[model samples]
Target: MRSFVRVLLGLALVFAGTSHLTFARQEFRAQVPELVPIDEDTTVLASGVAEIGLGSALVLASRRRRLVGTVVALFFVAVFPGNIAQWLNRRDGFGLDSDEKRIARLFGQPLLVAAALWSTRGGSRQRS
Candidate 1:
């Protein structure tokens, strides 16, 4: 179960990271917080790179799985503000034009964090 979830999470991250760099690049830009000092596109690119690194680590670094999970969970936490920014700013993108959907997404971020922690080293026995 752990291995399955871990790999699934890893693949999801990889897909999202690649999307950040390509197809969803503009969509992701909508989530950038207004308070962020950097250019929105730059923020998207930086986070895209980070997602790839974290995804790779989760998939390949068995010895450091716990650390990888921790980092990925933290990454989820870190990006949460952008979610809030999108809601508050009413910046619609990624088909999140509706407030209810956006609000649901805000709540969903924690689930990703929990999944990251649970799948890796939070409690499940380490496997692969």
Candidate 2:
């Protein structure tokens, strides 16, 4: 069951990461116009690639589980700034609203971070 959950979580991350990598330049720009000046497209693409790599590592071997978890956690923390940037700018870019909706969108980052941490820790536990 635990491994199943881990694989599911990994797949989810992989999908999301791939999506970001695929459309980071366009979708991200469309979602947050201000990001244009900040070179967000490149940053998001790099992050997406990092996410894919980390997600792949998570399902590789139990011996490296801790390392993979640590890297994923770090990646989550690293990308948090982009979330904050979007919130602060509050512009409709990536099909997201630029106004009040920004508040809800801002909360998503911490939730994702929490989930990533939970998945990592849960996967690292010894099975009964």
Candidate 3:
């Protein structure tokens, strides 16, 4: 069950990353805070690349599953402010148009973090 959830999370990230690079680029831009130093497009692109890499690691890095999970959780944590900014600034993205929807979405992020950690738990180190 845990592995299944992890794979699902991985696939979701990959899909989101692809969206960031393509069709949903503009939507994702809504999450970029005005305070961000870099261009919004550049930030989106970089985050897309990162999501793809982290997602791939979650799916494929068996020996280092714990490490991958930790990084993925941290990644989720790192991006959380964007979610907050979107809500605070009244920026709509990913169909989260209303303040209610955006706030609900904010609550979901922690579950993603927990999923990443829970799915990768247990198991002794298998020497590389």
Candidate 4:
């Protein structure tokens, strides 16, 4: 079950990353925080690359799966501020136009973090 969820999350990340580099580039830009030092487009592109690398690690890493998961969770945590910025600044992206929708989207970040950790945890053996 964990493996299944991990793979699904990995694939989802890959797809999202691909969208960041392509069709959804503009949408992702809306999520970039104004305080980010880099240009919005560059931030999006770099994050897209990061997502791809992390997603691939989630799918492929075995001996270090827990480490990969930790990194993935950290990545999610790292991006959370951008989500908060979007909500606070009323920036629309990924169809989260309303304040309510944006607020609701914020709730999903923790779940992603939890999922990343849970899915990569060692099963019934020893916790890493």
TM-score of each: 0.93, 0.72, 0.95, 0.95
Candidate 3 clashes between residue pairs 3 or more apart in a chain or in different chains: none
lDDT of 2 by residue, 1-128 (tens): 54665677677778777988785456654443353455767766766777777777766646666566667767767766666666676656565675667677767767666555565565325431
Worst 10 residues of 2 by lDDT: 119-128
Which model, 1 or 3, shows the larger TM-score? 3
Once superposed on the true structure, which residue ranges of model 2 sit more than 4 Å away at CA? 30-38, 122-128
- Model 3 scores what on Cα lDDT? 0.90
Candidate 4: residue pairs that collide: none
Taking the tens digit of each residue's C-alpha lDDT, what string does model 1 give over 74-125? 9999999999999998889988998998999999999999999988864455
Report, for every candidate in turn, its global Cα lDDT versus the true structure: 0.90, 0.64, 0.90, 0.93
- Better structure of 1 and 4 per lDDT: 4
**In model 4, which runs have C-alpha deviations exceeding 4 angstroms?**
124-128
18-120 per-residue lDDT for model 4 (tens digits): 9999999999998899899999999999999999989999898778889999999999999999999999999988889999999999999999999999999
Most TM-score-accurate candidate: 4
**Model 1, total clashes:** 0
